[model samples]
Structures are given as structure tokens and as C-alpha cells.
Target: MDPQNYPSMDQYNYSNNGGNNNNSGYRNQAPQQHQQQQPQQGGGYPPQYNQGYQPQQQQQQYNPNQQYSPEQQGIGMQQRGGSGNEFLISSISSNPLAQVGFSYGQSLFNDGKQYVDSNIGKYFSFSSLKSYFNVNTSYVFNKIKLIIFPFPQKTWKRRIYRVGDVDSYLPPRDDINAPDLYIPLMAFVTYYLLYGFQLGMGREFSPDKLGTAISKGIVGWLIEIGIFRLGSFFSNSYSIPIYDMIAYSGYKYVLMVITIISSILTGGYISFFVKIYLVACLGVFILKTLRVVMVSDNSANSHHDMHQQHEGSAMRNYFVFGVAMLQCVILFFFN
Candidate 1:
């Protein structure tokens, strides 16, 4: 009966029944009470956690895509003040200076037109004239032969000499005399050089003299072109182009060069005689060439009626003579 039976006080305290099971139930209930108190003090539940996070996400999404209203744009423009308003006005308004300049130009153009109209015929306009300078080597050789020797038979055979020949060789058909600038250009340069040489020898080789010579050459060329244009207009045939006439006119420079060389070498009337002879031959050549080339359908009929054609032929010869006389005059004056 000793200490072995001494559990009496503990058994009375609940060790004899289900005391251990009750203690375990109290532990579980204590944790549930703590969990219930946690939610009342800002601790998030699973559903409430997403509710706060959702608003933050919405703010971030809208921030990047937001646009300023028109009212905001107006506020920005007003902030720039007068400079912005000036730029806008300048962009919309037309310039007064530009309008004045246009009116001035129109008045000047009208004045020029009036002056041109007042002196139309005397004012010889060459606005529509064109020139080509490509002469064939064979044609050039023939031209030289005709000018130097004045041999009628051989020269006539070599070039277009008759109305029928013109029909065979003129434009719409290619011929030996298909306008070339080579001989004409070479001749012009040679003439210019010879002229300078002559001036140098004459002790009149100032810059002003050289300029005068060049201007004279240019004026002479223009006058020659004008003369030919007039001839074509009056002859009633615009068959030959301005370039061909220019080529023909430039050919005279070749003779001029030769005469100058002869004058420099021989220093006598020999040069003068040669010039006279060449000028005469050139006139005859032009007469014959232009007569055939400028032929019309009525020209052949005129041949049958010589009385009717005589006046036309005479006029053509006179025009050729005038061109030849002009050449002689230029030679005398310039050389």
C-alpha cells in the first residue's frame, strides 16, 4: 500500500478519464481564434489581395495609353505667346513684295512688245534662225575647185546644178552636201587668226582692236544670215535651211584667208586681183546653186515661157550679185 498507490491526487485531477484528448482539442481551437483575429488588423484574405492589386494594375495600363485633350493643346500653344501666332499668320499670308515684282515684270514685257511692234521690219529678228555646220569632205573639195578654178563642167557634175538634181538630192533624201560645220568652223578660226596676224603686222594689235574685229565678224555673220533669210522669203521657197545658208556664207572666209596670206607673202596687187576674181566666182556659184535649189513647180513652166521667167531669173541673179557685193564690201572694210 505504499507509494505505488500514490496516484490518487493525479487521478482526481482528470488523469483517469479522457484528459489527453481534451487538451489536443483546446490546442486546435486556439490556433483558429488567432487566425480569425488576424483578418481584422489589415491582413489580407485571398480574395481581398487581388482586389487591391487589380486597381494598381489598371492605373499602370491606362497611364501609357492616355492622350492629351484639345484643351491641353490650346494651353501649350498659348504658353508660346506671340512668336507662335506670327509663324501661323506668316504661313497663311501672301507676300506683298512678290506681288509688286510680278507687276513690274509684266509692265516691262509690255513695253518691250510695244517697241518691237513699232520697228518690226527694220528690226531684223533672228530668233527663229538655226544653223548646222557639217559639210562633207567631197563637197568641200568640189567647192574649193569651183571657187579656185571656176570650171563650170566639173563643178556642175559634182553638185546639185539643176531643178531635177534638187529633186533627187534635197531634204527627205540624203546627199553629199548634208550641212556640216567642220569646214565652216575651221575656215572661221583660220580667218580670225589671219585677221589677228594682219592686225599685228599693221601695228594695230591692241585689245580694243581685237575686240572690234571679233564684233565685226559676228555682225557680218548675222547680216549674211539675215540676207539669206530675206532671199528665201522673197524667192518663195523655204527649202534650204538656215544652217545650209550659214555654211555657204562661212565658206567665203576661206577665200578671205587665202587672200590675206597672199597679201602677206606677195605684198602686191596680186592679192587684190585674186580677191576680185574669187568674189566674182562666188557670186556666179551662188546664182547657179540657188537657182536650182530654190526652184518651184512653176519654175519649169517659166523656162518654157522665158518672157515670164526672165524677171524672176533676173531678180535671183541680182540678189546673188548683192550678196557678192556685200562680201566684197566686208572684205574691203575689215581687211
Candidate 2:
């Protein structure tokens, strides 16, 4: 082998060292190239980290002048409005005046409900009175005819029904002889309207006048109720229900309405003779209707002593006559 062609020991060691240095340089350059390529791939960060960080930058740099669609604006407005409403409700709940008003209204409602349930509810059994309004068209037509001419109805006694060993009168729907408040209330309203109409025809109609007429009619009705109650008390007769008495007394209003209607049709004024004839019809109706209430049943009278029954019967007849006579005065006043 030739030593000069290969190299001396010193030169050989230098060449070996240069070779190791060049290999290390290539290894170091490989890592530097990978680090440089990282920036081009994903901005020198992990993909997930970049993804998270970009959203934050976008939020911070968001445009304030961006316009939204109507639906989006509405949704945003509703959210704000809902918050505002909550704030307003809180403010109202804390206000003393609002609290006071609420409490006052609640108290008034409770008091009114209690008053109606206590005083008025006791006398008026609304459940039972519902039957009065159960009348059909035929019943109403026949009832009007009977009221105008009651002398033809031979049967004045109200139908009796037995229920669990107790006897109860049939409702007006089932029996024509039964008393009802529906006709009376309707007739009373009709009379008022007729009266108002008459006044208008005469060029004397006024709200105050109409109000006064209604008040007078109501007062008259109450007076009749008082008379009937007193008579029942004094005569020691078989007392009917107070509502029945109200119904009986209210029948006069039907006649009064008819009379006023006749007057309006004839000459727009009630004549004295026409008033007298109506009074006679109303008196006869009242007398016949009250016979069922004022007179004691034989079965009921059997419970009383002879003297007591006889005395009661005599007083009842007197009271009934007096009540019938009162119709003339009431009819005349209405006219």
C-alpha cells in the first residue's frame, strides 16, 4: 500500500474530524428546516390551539356597525325587553301605593262576595228559582192569556208532588197554576220601557224622569211585598216562600205593562176607565193566585185545633180581600 496516496496520520485525523462536524451540521439543519416549516403549516402553534385562539381575536375585533336581519333584531330586542319587564315588575311589587291598591281591590271583592252569599243568597234559592225560567214558548203564551183572563182557569190549586214522604209544589214549567218570577221580571222591565216610551212621545222624556219612574216602581213592589208579609204574619195563615210572595206581587207589573201598551196603542195615554178595567182583572188574578197560599189545606188544618183553624180562616179571608183591594190603588198609581 502507498502511505502518501492515502494521507499522513495528522491529516487523516483532521479529515476524520471534519467528516464528524459535517454529519452534525446536517443533523442540526434537519431540525431547523422542520421548525421553519411549522410556521407555514399552522402559524407555529398546534391546530386545536390556533382554532381556539382565532375565535377570541375575532370577538375582540368584531364590527360594531354590523346590521342584523329583522328576526335577529327582534330576538335581541325581546331579550332586552324581557329583562326590562322583570325590572318593572320588581319595581311595582316594591311600591307601597300599588300594594295598597291591590289589597284594597282584593278586600272589596271578598266583602262583596260575602255580602251576597250571606244576606241575599239565603232568601233567593237560585237553584230552585232556575225552574221558573224553564218555561217554553207555549207556556209563556198560555200564561199571558191566563193572566189577562184568569176567570176561565177553573183549577187554581198548585200541583203537589210527593218526594221521600214530603210534599212539594210543582214548578211553573210543569204546572200553569205554579207561580213564577220570570214573567213578572220581564213584565216589570217592559212596563218601564213603555213608560219611558210614553214620556218620549209626550216630549217629556229625561234620564232623571226615567230613573225616577223605575225607582217608584221598585218602591211599589217592595211595598206590596211588605203588605203580603204583614198580612201573612197577622192572619196566622199558611205562609208561602218569600220568593213566591215576590212572584205573586210582581204579576201586577204584567197587567201594568199591558195597560201601558194599550194606552200607547190607543191614544198614548191611559184613560181612567181603561185603568179601572185592568185593576179589576189584576185583582181577580191576585185573589185566585193567593187562595193557594193564604188558605190552609185541610190536611194542614187537621193538625190545628178547630177554634184556631176557624180564627185563622176568617183572618185569611179578610187579608186576601184587603190585598185584592190594594191592586186598584197600585194599578191607578202605575197609570
Best by TM-score: 2
For model 1, give the 10-residue run with minimal summed lDDT: 168-177
Worst 10 residues of 2 by lDDT: 52-61
Clashes of each: 6, 0
lDDT of 2 by residue, 129-151 (tens): 78777787777788888888887
Q: Which stretches of candidate 1 lie over 4 Å from their true place?
A: 1-139, 154-179, 296-314
Q: For candidate 1, what is the total of clashing residue pairs?
A: 6
lDDT of candidates 1 onward, in order: 0.65, 0.81
Residue-by-residue lDDT tens digits, candidate 1, 34-119: 99887555544565655564434334345766898898988867768767788867855577876788789999999998788678
Per-model TM values vs. the true structure: 0.50, 0.65
In terms of TM-score, how similar is model 1 to the real structure? Answer: 0.50
Error of 1 at 292 (Å): 2.0
